[model samples]
Target: MKTSTRLEQAIKKLYVAFHNNTLHPECCKQCAVGNILNNTDSWKHLSDYHGALELNYIGKVNESFGRKFNGYSPSELLKIEATFLKACGYQLPLHYKNSKPKHPTNKDVLFNGLTKVVTFLCELDGVSNVMDYTKLFEFINEKPRFQLDDVITF
Candidate 1:
């Protein structure tokens, strides 16, 4: 089984989180990416010029793959975060509480987000659909130093 890259697993996790609607803090009433979409006050707390929020989904993705801001360069991490958000249909540089992108239709939101995830996955790494959470867990849990290269293509 070829191991998935850090980028691949992160994209997958973000997709799953978005799918499950558990990607954000409970108090925010929005997923992590949702914060960026709304450009609410929460977005600023998640990431500034200093560092990515260790408690947010983006940070969790970074931590899951043993990545460390790729050396504390928060801007780079934010770029990755912004890319993911953009893939989900949100524009960048969330500057205000009312900053918003063209809101996706209810049905299209998931589609857009997933599409972005797939594109990012493909471009950042060579991973594809890579679905199946149970298998991912098995792979990650079975090995002490499991490489996240085993992926399922849709």
Candidate 2:
């Protein structure tokens, strides 16, 4: 599937961050947006609060100036962060004591966050969700590869 060059780059970065255990929802420099921006915390200035979708004064100025970090506008970046936080079970506007996963580096948790971020990015770019595998389930010869309830004998 064809994807924008920038989105492709962003996905690669996020994938690496997830596998390298560098992705963290709490840290601005290691969060989804940060990873997409080359692990820079500067994207935090785009919003007054972490996980917020509203752009602050600085963010508005940057948006007005048509500035993009790794090809994402200020608003897009904010949305991406918000999506990641939500997927990771974070309360909006992240707090030190807020309810979070017991192990942030847990692969399952990170994968959930990555899936959400990738979905949002795909939507933003008007492309199909890269993480979606539903198409792979489409029937061939009017039969699925396997039944959902099928038991495996190993």
Q: Who wins the lDDT comparison?
A: 2
Query: lDDT for model 2, on a 0 to 1 scale?
Result: 0.86
Q: How accurate is candidate 1 locally (lDDT)?
A: 0.45
Tens-digit lDDT string for candidate 1 (36-147): 3332333334454221323456545555676543132333344545554555555444434423445533436655655654555454454444444455555435573433
Clashing pairs in 1: 2-149, 2-150, 3-148, 3-149, 3-150, 4-148, 4-149, 4-150, 130-152
Backbone clashes for every candidate come to: 9, 0
Among the numbered candidates, top TM-score falls to: 2
**lDDT to native, each model:** 0.45, 0.86
lDDT of 2 by residue, 1-154 (tens): 5689888999999988988889888898999998999988998988889988999999999999999888989999999999998898888888887787788778888899999999999899998787766655767788886554332211
